[model samples]
Target: PRLLRAAGVAQVVPPLAARDGRLHVPLCRQAGGLQLAVFAYITGRGGADAPLGREQWRQFGATLRAVHQTPVPEPLRRALPTWQEPGEVGRWLQRALPVWRRQKGRTAAARALIEVIGVRYDELQALTARMLALHQRLGERIAAGELRCALCHSDAHVHNLMVDQQERVWLIDWDGASWSPIERDLMFVIGGLSADLLRPHETEWFFEGYGPVQIDWPALATCRYAWAVTDVHAFAIEALGERDEARASSSAAWFERLFAPGEIVALAREGEAWL
Candidate 1:
C-alpha cells in the first residue's frame, strides 16, 4: 500500500492503521488470535458473474499495467513466487492424469462424466495432452528468457475488480499476488470471464490501456487450459469423492462448456488473433 502510494498509483485501497499506528490488528481478539487489516471501502457492484462496463474494462487494463509496472521493493521481489518454478509444470500434469485414465469400476464415474459432457474419452485425453505439451513448450521458453515475469495479481478477474462511484477502478484480492508471467492474470479474464460474458471487445480496450507488451501465445494458451482443466477437474473429483452423484454430474456439465471439442482451441485462437 505504501509503495503504490509513493509511486502515484491511483484508486488503490490502502490498509488502514489502528491507534497504535499498526497496519494489522487482532481479528476480534478471540478468533484463535487471528489478525486482520481494514481497507478503504470501494463503492461499486459487479463481479465474475456481473461484469463492469466497456469503459471500465479499458480502465482495468490501465490499472493492471500500473500494478505490473510498479517497481518491486527488493525484499518483496525476492519473496514472491513464480510460475513453472521447479516441479510446478509436472504438478499440473499429475493432477490432470485422472482425467485421462481408463474407466473401470471406480473409474467408471469419471468416464461417465466424460460421456455426459458430450466429449469423447479420447477427446478429453487429447485435450489434456495438448495442455501439458503447451505447458512444456512454454516452460522451456520461460527458462530461455523468451517470456518475462512481472508482479501479477495471479487471481485477477472481474470478481476481484471494483468500479467506485466516481468510476475509478480498483483491484482487490491480494492473497494470490505474486511475481509471475503477466499472462497468469491475463488468462483468467480472457479465458474464463470472457467465456461467460462474450465480451471480446473488452480485451481490446484492455490492451489499449495496457500499452504494448509481448504476448507469449503458447504460454497464454497453457495458462488458459491449465486453469480451467485443473479447476473443473478438482470440482468433479471433490463431488465424486463425496459420492454426491448430482453434484458430480453438475460439475461434469459445467466443465463441458469449458472443454467441449473446439471450445478451448477456439478460445486460444481468438486470443492469439488479437495478439
Candidate 2:
C-alpha cells in the first residue's frame, strides 16, 4: 500500500489505524487486552459484480505497470514475498495431489468426483508438465540475471480490481503480491480469467499504455495455464471439503471449461513455438 502511494497511484486505499497509530485493533473476548484478533477496515469501490469497459482495462494495465516499475525498497527486499523460484500452482498441486488421492480411496463421493477428474487427468498432467518446464526457464533466467523481477499482483483478476465512480481503476487485495516476473501480472489480465472478457483492440490499448517490455512468452504461457488450472483444481478440492452437491457439480463444470478439448494442447504448442 505504501509502495502504491509512493508511486503516485491514487487508486489504492489501505487500512488506517484505529488509534495510537495502530493499523489494527483487538476486540476483548472477556474483560480487556485479551488480544483475540486484530482487524482493520479497507475502503474500496466496485466488486466481482462490477462491469468494466475498455478504458478501465487500459487503466488497469497502466496501474499494474506503475506497480512493476516501482522499485522495492532495500529494507523491504527480504521482507517481501517472491515468486518464480518455484511456481505457486506447482507447490499447491504437490500438496493437493496427495490429499486428493487419499480422499478418493476413503470416500465413495470422492471416488465419483475422481471419475470426473480422471476424464481430463491426461490433459491436466500435460498442462502441468509444460508449466513446470516454463517455470524452470523462469528460474534459470532469474538466477542468471537475465530477467528483471518486480512487484506483481499474482491474483490480478478482474474480481480483485475495483473501479471507482470517477472511473479510476483501483487495485485492491494485496494478499498475493510478490516479487516476480512482470509476465505474472500480464498473463493474469491477458490469458487468465479476465482474458475471455477482453476485446482484442482493448488488449492492444493495454500494451500501448503499459509501454514496450519484452515478455518471456514461455514463462507467461506457464503462468496463464497455471492460473486457469489452479482455480479449477482448488475449487474442485474445496467442493469436496464442502460436501455439497451443488458446489461439487459447479466444480465439475469449471473443470470441463478449463480442460476444453485441444485448449491445453494448443497452448502448449504455442508456448513451445516461442521457445
lDDT of 1 by residue, 66-149 (tens): 888889988988988767542354465455555544333234454576454334445555655666666677768878998888
Clashing pairs in 2: none
Error of 2 at 68 (Å): 0.7
Q: Which parts of model 2 are misplaced by more than 4 Å? A: 25-51, 85-88, 91-111, 261-270
| Alpha-carbon lDDT, every model | 0.66, 0.66
Clashing pairs in 1: none
In the range 1-275, model 2's lDDT, one tens digit per residue, is 66677668666666664558665466655657643323233344664565577687778777878888888888776776776534666667755654564465324455666776566566566666666767777788889998778888787767777766677777888867888888878865554454354456766777766777887877677666666556656766765665666666666556555555434334444556566
The RMSD of every model to the true structure, in order and in angstroms, is: 4.6, 4.2
The TM-score of candidate 2 is: 0.80
> Which run of 10 residues does model 2 get worst, by summed lDDT?
34-43
RMSD of 2: 4.2
